[model samples]
Target chain A: MRNILLTISYLGTRYHGFQVQKNAVTVAQTLQDAMEILLGRREDIKGCSRTDAGVHAGFYCLNFKTENPMPLPRIQRGLNGLLPWDISVRGCREVPEDFHARYDVLGKRYRYLIWNSPARSPFWEGRAYSYYPPLDLEKARAVCRAYVGSHDFSAFCSVKSDVEDRVRTVTHCGIEREGDLVTFTVEGDGFLYHMVRIMVGTMFWVNEGRLSVEEIPAIIASRDRGRAGKTAPACGLYLDRVFYDLEGLRWEEGKDLG
Target chain B: MADLENIEHLRKKRARIGFLKKALALLLIVAAIALAVAFRHEISRLNLVEQLTSHLVGIGSGPGWPVDISGITVREMAPMGNDLAVLTDTDLIFYSAQGREIRRVQHGCANPVMKVGGTRVLLYDTGSREIRVESKTRTVGSKTMEYAVDTGDISANNCVVLVTQGARYASEVTVLDKNLAQLYQWRSADSRVMVAALSDQQDEMAVGTVNVRDGQLYSTLLLFRFDEEQEYVREELAGELIHSLRYKQGCLQALSSRRLLTFSETGKRMAEYSLGEETLTAFDSGAELFTTLLVGDYREFKELDLAIVDYTGAAVGGSQLDFQVEDSTAAGDRVVLQSGGTLYLYGGGALLDEMAPLMEILDIQLVGKNLYLLTPSTLEKITVR
Candidate 1:
């Protein structure tokens, strides 16, 4: 059996989240089911991260051992055929036996979409969140700039979440607005549960004039969830991409890809 | 003399002790005051009385819901029991009551649209020319269209109707089953096929066409059946553009922008009503009743009105909304009109209640007995009264 790496995209609207839990359905389980049906055997899938439910992903990574020597084209088409319409496997490749989808990760990018229009479209029904009140875009951006660089994101994550360390390096966290669509993109080495959502929710509070941008340092120092804004909806959050040192996003018709 | 000497010695000792004690007390007091000033912020943090009072001043509660999933690019939603079928740009997701996705399928479709028909779902991708028929969690069957289909709809009885047009001259109509297999096909040889409607049983179909007679354009509706191979009824609608050809509640409704004409299933003219000469923006329907939002200039008058019209082409009741509605959805016995951040829920054509203002609401949908509010960040569920 050969270990394989797959790039994936999914609409999180119907998922319990990216990770599998008891009783609840997940994206990973769905992919595993499709893999089993395609290869006619069970394949243990290891996902890069445990994205919460309703969080979309433009690019995510996972690995599985496939005894079936299905070619790249066949695997892509076959798994896609067996999979549901909401989840898609973009590409697949054979990686080194020791290559891991999670451990060797260099960074990951996440994005959240905000519909700033007062009027919402039925087309955007489940896709983007609508923010009606006029927000201070300039100040909201300033708050985003403050999050750039490495820091302890203790207060930015779920208080109930117990991680050994809350220290994460945020290489980029910025906000951009095009018409009424507001996008928040962040690049980091790792994230805590609900960290991105809380960052966004708190940024909104800053824009709403409820919280000051200067209070962010104290909130981080406080390491308290109460100091941050509301956790933004999972619908607006998306796993944008995962980066490895060399593999990046290239998985062409090559002999080996990791 | 010895007593006097002892008294003097005692006085000297007492004076020296007093001076030393005073200096020590002053130094200690100064040190204590310096420490308090230096750690004032830290001391304030320990003030439990202030902390409780500050908690009281804090607004309601904060948002930290451990929500599982969020929705996106939702093209359409079909509420099923405690679940919802959401059609995104390229996929179909079936979500449980708690917003957990039970199943998902990637259609790789372009310009996708989904409709819930009876117990089956019809997912069509106009760009890919593909139609996938899904029942619950499984895709039962799928087929590809030869041409890019424009207007298509499915019935609860598992009938699919599609209108494909290459140009104004090249047009065709096809009817299919839940498997997306073509059961009936018709290509317009003389007139351009504008729109088509399928019956609930998948046994009957209606096609609307536009043909020229003596240089005058004429609109017509024809009834057909596969076994009969005959045009049961060919009703000519003069000068009226049949915008929508739908069979609702045992009647054929051919509605244009300004008029609605009803016909019997057997192709007999029943009744007709002239809507105000205005642009009909949106039309929402229930099991038996339908209403249209007419904006822009209405005849000579200009305002927004919700005209409730029945299948017999008669106006049930017309009410002018008090506010400019951004969007609205009506289902069962409830009609919700959203203006800005507030929602006005109406029952029996009268205002019932108003939802509190939200930060931003993109859309509001009535699912079963619950209210689904689409915000900028989440889809919140609220109980219906």
Candidate 2:
């Protein structure tokens, strides 16, 4: 038996979400159906993290062990042909057995896009957050920097999360703008549900001069969801990359990839 | 030319001042009306929040509860949200959760015992053989048994009834169906039946029996069919006194003086929960996600600490109120502990609210979702949102 790990991408605008839900058309459900059709049986697969509806993903990894004698390129072509255009199988590779997609994760990267131009763009609709007012770029940059390092991010997470521990470490967070598009890159050890969207909303609040730079640390210290900024729209979020420590994780055959 | 320009400037300034004064007067009138309307709405909204929140925290008014207690000896009171039932010495009064007395039944009682489940009520008269199942504004069923009941409980559907009677060593039990039809009867000549729990489905019963053998008290739990003595399971023990037996959801719980035990309907022991101290009195159970209230002394000071035990038999949290609590009942997702003159509200095993300075709380009953306080004079219905 060989464990096949696949990296996939999807335009989440038309899909419900990444998880398999009851009576809902989700990215996971569609991919699972395509796999069942290609393999003529069910394959046990799980995504690294769940994405909310209308949130796109540029990179995601899933692994499932199968005893099929088919080759990697053939399995990938078959599965992709069965899947919808919105979801595409980017690449598939043979990984060692016992490789999990979620638990062995080292870190993750997410990007949020914003259109600061006054004119409404039909193309960027469902792709970027549009704000006509002028934003103080330096103030936004300061709060983004404040989010770096280890801290409790309870205020940035959605209250629906029942997790007891909300402490996370952000290694990198930066904001840059070229023309009308302002891109935000955040790399963290872990992210809670809607953490990035709330952080983005808070950045704009700083730019709009509603919240101050000094209050960011106190908000993180409060550990209360009500003290945080509003959750930005799901359309502007994109899962960029997932980092894994292949050498540290247990796998058969003693082979590793970093 | 300079004098003409000055006259023109003064004329324009005067016109602007006149407009500004009129505009300011109109704005003041509009603001006053808006504030009056908002003030009225805020008062009612606060009233509604107090009536519905069920948090039982800092309440400013008794908008959806009883504000007065006219002098009357309330025999038994059952409060469940909007359906409130109060049994006086001579009449059974039904009231809404909002303190509105709806109906009064022409039923009298000598020593009455009432059990409120969901919205159904079971009232038994110890002096007589009368057992009546009632709800708000209506009598579901009534029966006159051959033996007077020491205590009784009807099923949630008002279909099955388990009534037990005992004096010294001889105790008897009767199981009845919805039409007051006798399904099972048992007489114990060598033991005293302390408590009996009838399943809500009316298919089985669990009885706690105590008998003195060799001058030692021995307790036995017997599970059997409602009508037949063909026992499904039976177990015996020698320890604390059995306080009560209750059938809630799908499990039959035996509440003892020291430990709490849950058993399946088929008589297999599921779990045993020991509170580490002797239970003071009968602990309340029978909620879906039940929070059992244990009032026992955890310190040498003899002060009672109210412990909230979740359904898993684990004490999640508790209040250190040290009040001499009489009884505590689970209402919705909250626990209402009633002592002499105070009511302690606990949610998620933590004390969320408390009401004190109350006039002698005799008993507290939760029906549906409302809490009914049976004081010396009135049956007060309170909702802890």
Candidate 3:
């Protein structure tokens, strides 16, 4: 037996999430179905994260063990032939049997896109969040700096989560703007439920002048869920990059800003 | 003196017994050799002798012969450009003339079926509404019908004909142009379309349909022009179910369960050949001038009689085969029959070539001089001798 790792990407508009649900279709179920056709047997899969419904992913990792010795190129071609048009297997490789896709993750980066234009784009519909208001770019950039470093983020966590330990380390938090599009990115060791969405929502509040950059640190100290802004829509968020080792990632401030 | 005479008589009796045993052993050895020679066709089907011979001669064991098709179940195949188009249960793959896979695309269908005409190939789902028209290189167009598709075909001029279940009638025929524009449509209130084909000139069409009349099933052949709403000729065939219909050399030829009927361009019945007691096992009318039929004594595992007839319903040439045929097809003037792992190619009523491939042949198609053989695990392209 050998452990096979596959990196995939999907639109996520038609899927419930990355996990198998009893009543709804999901990315994990779709991948498993395609794999079953290729390998001629069903193998259990492990995904890197439980992405929320309607949340897209640019890069997601999954692993499964199999006895079939199909070459990697043939496996990739066979899977592409079986998978749907919306989901695709980007790459595949054999990994160590002990390497777990979920447990071995060191950190993750999430990106939120905002189409800050008055008119909605037909091409980006169901793909990006459309906000018509004029956002104060300077205020949004300043608010991003306060979210870096370790802190108890109970204010940014979803109220539905019951994890008592709320302390997390945010390695990089940055905001950039390119014309009518604004991008907010955050990298962290781990996150609570709806943590990235809440952070993007808080940045939106600061951009709107409803909250100040100075109050973000106080909001973290307050440890109150009510102190943060609303969780942003799921369409704008993407699980962009997954890291098993943090030493390889290079970060720079205002690198992508227009 | 009496005891010595009795001993001599006993020795002579023992010698006679040994002589009889030697003769009996010689006769058994001769019978076994005769049986092996007589039943060689049955033994060849197990591929024991052919495999051993091919291994010793290093024939058909070379690379680049049998293209791998292990993962997909092939449903239909046809010649595309100089290559071949194979429609599986899920995908459409194009292989080169040398049996090398060139490209593959998902047809996104469950029960995928295919028809190839000129450079265009039409793929449709049997119980679904989706249909796609693709050329040798790329997809030309696609359409979704209002009702599920029953069957369809493509013309040499790239026109598409689709027969689908009707909303208000028993069946409907929709014709589309080369660019997938709606050209014409017809609906039948009582009959269901079984097979349809367009003329080579693209000016006329022939449709075969079946309907129950007074509790007796009847087959009808309808011929129509592209601009006319009503059929110019309708021939009713009682107690028959049409299996195939095609237009060849300005005449419409149709095959039913029991008869082969041909009609002239003026709606006149030219000739008809009926199978009185024998059963029609397999038939193909894809050839330019002749159609091949495999008929037997209405029983399984019986050797079939090959019948090659022209478009005028006249017998050209045929012969009885020693092996039961799985599939038979005709192209140009040659007829190819697949029985087990061997292929018999006959031209002008004479056997041209016989090849016993190393793999099992499931289906075969002879386009031009290239013979495409579908195996259980691969597709092989061989040249006719």
Candidate 4:
């Protein structure tokens, strides 16, 4: 059997997210069903991470073992043709037999979009969250800086998460503002369930003047979900990318690989 | 017999080496092809840039103009001249073609007022409940004449011909001579006037009224001639709940919850276009007879969608632009919309240009054929030739 890695993107407005649930439509279920139909076998497909409902994915990774002799290109083309319009398989490639999609992931990045306007938008109704109140930019930036470092992050994680290790290192976090639009981008070693959303919610409170930047440390220390801001809506959050080390992959000397 | 055996073994070894070489070469070739395919998207993006650069227009070598005012928002542009008036959060600024601020009218209210006009300036101060009119030309040494009316505009010379509020929403059609004196105040029969519009020639105005019954908003439109004795005529239009109304040329455009209705300035409904499930937020009429609709969240701290529709109630081709708010100022009036570090220009159903990223774009305006974008650092002029 040959292991194949696939890069995918999807608009997550319609599905329950990247994982499969009982009688619920999901990105993984659709991809798995399509693979089964094309290969005539039910092979377990593993995703790098799980994104919540209404959260988009620009670049997600998945892997599965197939015994069929069909080439990687054919599998990619077949899966793309069968997938829905909202989901797309960007690429497919053969990988080492030991390669796994989830455990091999080195880090992940996420972005949260905020539409800061006094008016509602019809076009971006499902795409972004609209915040119409005046926001304090400096306070939001300060709070974003506070999130950059290693911390338990227990207070930021959701109550329903089963993971026991809440300690995660945030490598980078920044906030940028364009005309009436603000985005929070964060890269970390790993994130707990609803961690990014809750962090964004805390930042929103900082922008709203209800919470101060100095209070972030206390919220992190509290280790209680109630101490943090309300969890941000799911629609505005997106899994931007997943990074992996390429030590084993071989490449041509003068050829650019990106 | 020993030499023959050695020769046979050497031949087998040579064949094995050849096969290994061929396999190595094949692996190298596959790796090269994969790398090329992986970078194909980046190469295509470069090609797009090259194509766009061939059609790019360079910025003119002009000196920077001084813009001292803050909270400035462009209101309307003049068709014949290079005149554009902007409403600041507190004051109104009029600019000449040379980028000189000619007039600045101050409104004492803390909240910003919405301004409307082509050559003449009408300021609607909702806080003070007053309407002020000023001519483009300096008639009284930069001092604008102000009027205090009892009710807001239910309709006026613009698409709103009457101004009314509360149960006794009184609408008065006042005609002024060149000196800004009230020539006549014509009152309407209805107590509440919700929407209004004025003709291009300033000779006629249409008024719409709303009466809420059983938690439903019902509306009516009326047209009046602005003469010595104001003549009133009621015309029937098929629509409900006029939320926004604007008059350009002789066409009266009213935005209802269901569709956009177009009527003659004389109150004749010409055509209707449905807006589907899209809600109307902010509406601005252009100088060249087009209207811009900023539809999104109407409350505080919400994102908005923008669309431009022409006079005939048709969506302007290539006029849909999306922007996201990244951060907001302390006052909440000035918001930063993320444009992905690029500037987009739209006019007449076409995207004019995607200019290089300037500072942050704060506000946009279509003045005559020139599109003016006020960035945080510069005022960019995009000429649609």
Candidate 5:
């Protein structure tokens, strides 16, 4: 059997998200069905991660095993052609039988957009939240900086999230603005559900003069979701990319010599 | 000769066995590496889910280095540019193409207000009656000679149009140059001007007046000469209760509560159509497109539609955009909309695309592009390409 990795992108607006559900349409179910049709067999496919409903992915990864020996390019093309317009496969590569897409991911990055305007936008009607009130970018930045380093981010996550470990490392966080648009970009080893949104919500308090940037340490120490800003809407957030170690995939002299 | 042949055969057999062993070893190594990779990915995924759940449950610090700002609000977001301009409601803050702070203008305004015009930054202070024009190389500031009027608003043409209604009770539309100098002021025969809009060229102004006896608002799109006398030469359109009006290119677009109307600059009615049952929530006009957003019922939040109108007052394309409120508590969160080549969506107080439960979209803005969205945030700096 051959294992293959697939890189994909999809619009998350309609489906239940990236994972498959028993009765709901999902990106995974759709891709699995398409693959089943192309391969003429029921193949169990796995996704890199499960994105919640309304969550979008720019670069997502998945893998499936098959006994067929078709070329990698054909698999990528055939699956893309059969999938819906909103879902697209960018590339595919054959891997050793043991390789897995979700299990091999090293880290992920996400971005959040804020439209701070006084008038509601007709174009961005369903895409962004209209924050009419003013914000303090400096305070937001300071709070963002506090999110860096390895810590238990229990304070910034949503309730009802069932995970074993709360500890994660945030590699980077920053706030930026142009004209009337502000954005927050964060990268980390991993994230909690609604972590980015709640962090943003807490930062809003600082930006809006309600919370102090210095208080972030206390908030982190508390590990309370109620202390953070409202969980931001789902539309404005995007999974930007995922990273993996590139040791054996590409030519390495040490491995080659060994 | 027989002994030599036997030795050669033995050597060949040994060589073949060695090659096979090497191949098997290589295969094992590859398998191990693949397994390791797969294991790492699985562990990370589990760790991520656990970390996410724990964080959501308020146990650990979330992802990234925590950044603390006074406050952060997405002021304006452009999907095509993947860039957002945010303001802290204080001074001028400019972000680079890579989401970095490039420049900031301190003490730029006591109360900074911005009107977007084809990538131009027309900033004004109602309190000080001051105007500042910002571009790439030059930052110019000017003050109006007259006192700041109560009902003054800037037009797409960068003209400040005002209607003063106290004491004198006279209707006036003053055309100001970029320097805030009174180029000309056109006074109406009657004193009750209801609404006004400036032509895209800044050469003309349209005014609406209410006829009390008929209990209806009568609007006339007037042509004015800014250079010479500033006199109204002709009346463009007379309509009842002009609810909204916008001037783009050479055409004057107006909307009553019940119908959509278009007029030419030469005082001629171009076209008129009924708006039907959908209540117009917002309207915007660009050089190439006129957009209108309509909402049905709040409880049902029933039908949300975006109608794109051409210059000739014809509906070229229309589509229904859906938004879910989830429940009653999700109400009151402002939905932000923006348009350039395509429409962008945001709700729940954060910019869209950050937590997109849908597809990944890049938000971008070109230098000198005019982006219009509704928020209460102050306007930051405008980047000139």
Candidate 6:
């Protein structure tokens, strides 16, 4: 048997989420169906992370063990041919038989997009979150900086999650603006349920002057979820990249950010 | 042999389950595609029930709808006889006065200009020489002019008047009857014809021409008879270009940049109202009893003044509005002024009602109490009451 790693991207507008469910269509189930058609048998897939409904993935990692001797390129092309247009297999590679797709992940990056315009864009429907008020990037940048380093992010995680240990180290955090699109990017070793969305939502409050920029650290230390802002919508959240190497995806301070 | 048969039967049963699963997946895909097409607008927002209701009822389509005009460029919209006509670059669509889509006709005009006359409409391409005249249901006739069309109009009787570049002169006015037969043709000598109109009575045609003389612009209003060799009545105004000219009840009403002047059929000035220094922003002479005008102090319309004047150049109703007027139209005795998403309705020289619509109002047309509003995406009808 050979263990394979796959990097994939998908537009999650029409999907329920990354996890498979009995009644709902999900990314995992779709991939399993496509792989069954291509390899003539079912293969269990392990995803690196679970995304909410309407949350997209620009780059995601997954792994599956198969006894069939298939080339990486053929597996990619064959899976792409059977999968829907919105979901695509970006790259494939061989891994050790004992390698795990989820447990071995070093860090991951997430990006949230905001269309900061009064008028809605037709092309960006279902792809971005539309915010009418003008965003103050300087204040939002300060909020992003306050989120760097390590802290218990219980204030930012959703209350529905039952995880006891919520402490995580955030490696990189920044915000960039290009024309009408505002991008908020954060890299962390792991994320709790809806943690990135909550951080972005709190940043939005700071931008609108509803919350002070200096209060972000206090909110994190308080560990009270009610102290933070509301969770930002899932449509604007995207799993941007998954890093297997610690030194490869670390962001240098004051460096050019996309 | 019996053991081999048992294994083969089990293999066949497992293969049957796989085939059934594949078939079920295909069926789900087809059903999903069907649902997406049926509820495209609502599916974008994931409001499936509202979409089903919109499809089933066809009324009360929520404040967000009448279909999003994301990719459509609406050129012009006007009120047909009893329906509303919206002309885009690719299609001419008609809707009932109740705001239900009635019919549509495909058109091929690159730079389309639409002129509505009664139940018929004239679609002309300024980039090309093609003109198509269509009724509410189907196209009546189509014609190709010798030169590029400059501007055109259609009379209530369906008589078409087109101003095109003349081969031997500056411009020409060509009139065609309802059947598209050439009724009258005249070529200008030196002036460029800015506007042309056929009288409601259909016995006369009027042309407004502008030319520069002695370093100043001069405009002339000429009325012609079909049987006459030359213009029957000619009137000239110096330094003012005529914007619109129409005939109402034997009086020829001409609106220029600075004034509204009315003249008799024999070219005698009747009653004139000077606008002084105020800039005329918009005017509509579609109504028979009154014409509505919106004026502002500067071209950048901040606060506007609305003037409703009768054909005899008398003010029926007028008011200074605090908001800028985007568009205004008059029909019967009512005038509707659209400012942003709000509409101010006036009837009998009094402010009747002020309404704030859910969608943005791009243009408006008023007929009695039924006001047709054109938004970026949909055509809506609202009653003044």
- Worst 10 contiguous positions by lDDT, candidate 2 chain B: B53-62
Error of 5 at B205 (Å): 65
For each candidate, give its TM-score against the true structure: 0.46, 0.46, 0.48, 0.42, 0.39, 0.49
The CA lDDT of each predicted structure is 0.72, 0.73, 0.80, 0.64, 0.60, 0.81
Q: Candidate 2 - CAPRI tier?
A: incorrect
Query: Arrange candidates by lDDT, highest first: which order?
Result: 6, 3, 2, 1, 4, 5
Maximum-TM-score candidate = 6
- Global CA lDDT of candidate 4, please? 0.64
Off by over 4 Å in 3: A1-258, B1-64, B298-301
Q: Who is ahead in TM-score, 3 or 5? A: 3
Each prediction's RMSD over C-alphas, in Å, is 35.3, 23.2, 28.9, 29.8, 34.1, 34.7
DockQ of each: 0.01, 0.01, 0.00, 0.01, 0.01, 0.00
lDDT of 4 by residue, B293-332 (tens): 5554322112355555677666654243334323211000
Docking class of 5: incorrect
Model 5 Cα shift for residue B141 (angstroms): 84
Better candidate by TM-score, 2 or 4: 2
Tens digits of lDDT, candidate 5, B1-385: 9999999999999999999999999999999889868798654423333333322332223332111332444333322122233333554543433334433454355565554432224556645545565422235455553444434445543456665543454665666655556766866656466666676566776666555445534554455556656444444333345655667667777776556777777747788766644455544442334534343332222235555566678765554543322211011122324332233432322334322212221232222233222222222222211
**Which of the two, 3 or 4, has more DockQ?**
4
lDDT of 1 by residue, B178-275 (tens): 55667887777677777787776467888888878887678877888766766788878766666777777767777765577787767788887676
Lowest lDDT 10-residue stretch of candidate 4 chain B: B327-336
Q: Over the stretch A81-144, how does candidate 1's per-residue lDDT look in tens digits? A: 9889999989888888887888867777788889888898677666777777766778888888
> Per-residue lDDT of B1-385 in model 6, one digit per residue for the tens?
9999999999999999999999999999999999879888655433344334323433332443243456777877776655567888899987655556666888887778899875578998875788999875567889999998999999866788999987788998999987789989999979999999888666788899999988989999898988886898888888888999887776778999988988777667888888865678888888776777777642221246778888777887877664566677788668777777788887745788889988777777775667766676666667775
lDDT of 6 by residue, A1-258 (tens): 999998899999989989898668999999999999888888999999988889999988899999989888999999999999999999898887887879988778899999999998887778889977898888888999999999999998887789999999998899899999999999888999989988998887787776898899999999988778767778899999887642343344333333
